[model samples]
Target: MRITVLVTAKRNPDLDGAACAIAYAELLREEGYDAAPLVDGNPDAEARFALDETGWARPAVSMSASEIVLVDASDVVGLPDAVSAERVVEVIDHRQHHDAERLFPRARIQIEAVGAAATLVAERWRAAARRPRGSTALLLQAAIQSNTQRLRGSVTTPRDLDAAAWLAGIAELPDGFVEGQFAARAAEIVADVDAALSRESKRFDHPEGSYVVAQLELPGAVGLVDAVAAADLARTERVMVNLVDVDSARSLLLIWDSAFRRWVAARLGVTFTGAGAECSPAVLRKQIVARLRGDAS
Candidate 1:
């Protein structure tokens, strides 16, 4: 029972990762490829919200596939052992750290500096002279908006804006779709802090130590910093909680273990208060991780 091609998101996937995988799989299927989306880990709150709102089917985990197409991320660190470089047939990524051409030299690589991987997926769909329908269009649109913070994020590119606009036009969604989605995600996080944090956190194992980076956007900043679920991720060697107030475009960072906190503070040249540090102009979790790896683009 050999599967031809399987598309998967990196472990601890968020809305962008999961949506891009599913949407890209749809594109592959439309092109007469036997493709299916597989989730490497449980979906986070934002991903769950997208699935629920868009009504897209939940993806299964099993993968007995001959080839793999990775979306949203291209790093081997977060992927399963089964996904080797040879098995990788394609990779669509938006981050700077991944060199798909270098890692999977024979694979079809599309690594751009766009705000979201979904933007690239949308571009591919358009390039094929096809339009995504219903949930596919909605999910891709939502992914671009979420990743780019409704085109207000520092990393947002013109490609992302155009792709999102095209998707919204096809879906017949209102211009305020992003605001509604952002509000809903924040409400979901506020309703259950522990569930939200655990779902959003992604773990990384480095030469120095292992750590978890958790992030969630809120409607507002009130009472959010104190409500972070740092203790829930006790298994992690260190924890970094990013609390974003979407309404104000502000962010706060909370770190556990004084040594790690101090190290991060020194790196950013910020005050290491016992409470939490404010990240002015608000950086996303992806940006923070990139900075840590010295791969910020």
Candidate 2:
């Protein structure tokens, strides 16, 4: 069967979105299917998740026209509407409530708030005893390590840990390789106020609706400027934004035009700081949705 794999993610190569797409494509090919990876945006760009490399020509235009589209969950933001709803499928992901059912009711949706989708992919590989060789294994390993935050993120689960251990054994990585990878990723974040404020921001979906989680990743020291900017940005972005400095681990939640934020704040007993800004969270959410719809926002 003709299958097209679409991997979507924020424009960051350091992320694991592209690697996950490649891993998925390899698995599908082994299953006797014609599978190719199609990433959103310019394949030759330097941005994150971009597919720029020699011999990596633009994927055949017909690839997207295939009968099946297996999307990397991170790439969900860049999905096109031309494909049939029945053909769209998703790999495991950390994204919370999404509009997947409405867009692709036939999609084999698999969402897990765990370490990384690569862990699930690895599980599938082990179950099938389909050993990946050389580059494929390396790529998958990098993806798993990166997504797990080097086994430090709160999302890391037992399944993720088991998968990592198994993959490490099979891949036989050198000492400190995994730790080095995590350190490199962490170092990419700038130490400025923007970077600090952006670090804690996340996106999630709930039955009531979807919202953005903004947190601050600060060192132990609290700065008034960083805190103020984070609160302003959260309001301007229009989603429920929370700020937390990694050092203090203190978090501030700002819900837009809803009592939920207050309730959460009170329940958590964390004082809500910062003057509310004028940005609309609904607008920001809509923008994100539009981007996922393949509209250039």
Candidate 3:
């Protein structure tokens, strides 16, 4: 039978995107719809760790689907080849620099600036008055913790906090679970920073400029700025590297393009001592994009 809803995230989703896909698909199935979660590419190290910890495996999903629901993904570029823009019936994302409505014209869109898209999916479970299974709740809870840095990130919202709290009651996550997740991710990054950088990179085309932003997130990535060699990120196109310390809540932006560096310096009020500049209380990539596109208030 054809799948009614094929829920997915970006090409290689992190925990936030992967959790939303699986959890929202569960919600759809509970509502009596034929739905399943499918990721086009492999999830990142952090997501892999969570899936293993929760023992939440991906079930079979039909490649040909009647409709698609994109969670934590908004742009056409991130859409998998199997999911044509016309097939996307719904888009639920939490980013400011989004092209959801414009790209997926027929899709019902919800693009808020919340910390994690999983927060919205958790709210749906609460709205329906249906409790998710323990593993599902755990996944959503982990995603919120990762995205919001345990409710310390600047993008965190009250909705994120409430959803996390509700899920906490259901999940009963173990003590030091967040710490373990962070340590696992840090080991993966510190082992091979270049690969970590490549794994988490994303490209954007805003009205201000078209460029790519590569990110590395861990507890103390701020110290790894000089070792990152972010100056070589730009092969032909403009590229910027953001090394974010999620624990301490700091960001170090590495600029390879001098002209673009000047632009960012002017916009963000930062002076580059060398090729990198640090911003405390860390700013997310979406926030930078929002500021440049005038989406920030």
Candidate topping TM-score:
3
TM-score, structure 1 vs. true = 0.78
Which candidate leads the pack in lDDT? 3
**Which segments of candidate 3 are over 4 A away from where they belong?**
1-3, 206-209, 234-237
> Each candidate: what lDDT?
0.77, 0.49, 0.84
Q: Model 1, poorest ten-residue lDDT window? A: 228-237
lDDT of 1 by residue, 1-297 (tens): 334788988776778988888888888888888888876666666677777777776656457788999898787767755587788988999876655787887688888888899999999999999987778898888888788766776667899989988987888555665666676677778788788778777876556676788887766753676666345653344788887766666677887667788767776666756747886667787787777776646
For every candidate in turn, the CA RMSD to the true structure comes to 4.0, 8.3, 2.3
How would you encode candidate 3's per-residue C-alpha lDDT over 1-297 as one tens digit per residue? 435889999888888989999999999999999999986687877888888899986787787888999999888776677799999999999887766778999999988879999999999899999999999999999999998877887778999999999998997778887887888888888888778777777777767778888888898887777667743464445678888888887888888678888988887778887778888778788887677666654
How many residue pairs in model 1 have overlapping backbones?
Answer: 0
**All candidates in order of TM-score, best leading:** 3, 1, 2
Candidate 2 lands at a TM-score of: 0.63
Stretches of candidate 1 above 4 Å error?
Answer: 1-3, 11-13, 39-42, 58-64, 76-86, 99-106, 174-180, 203-211, 229-238, 256-259, 271-274
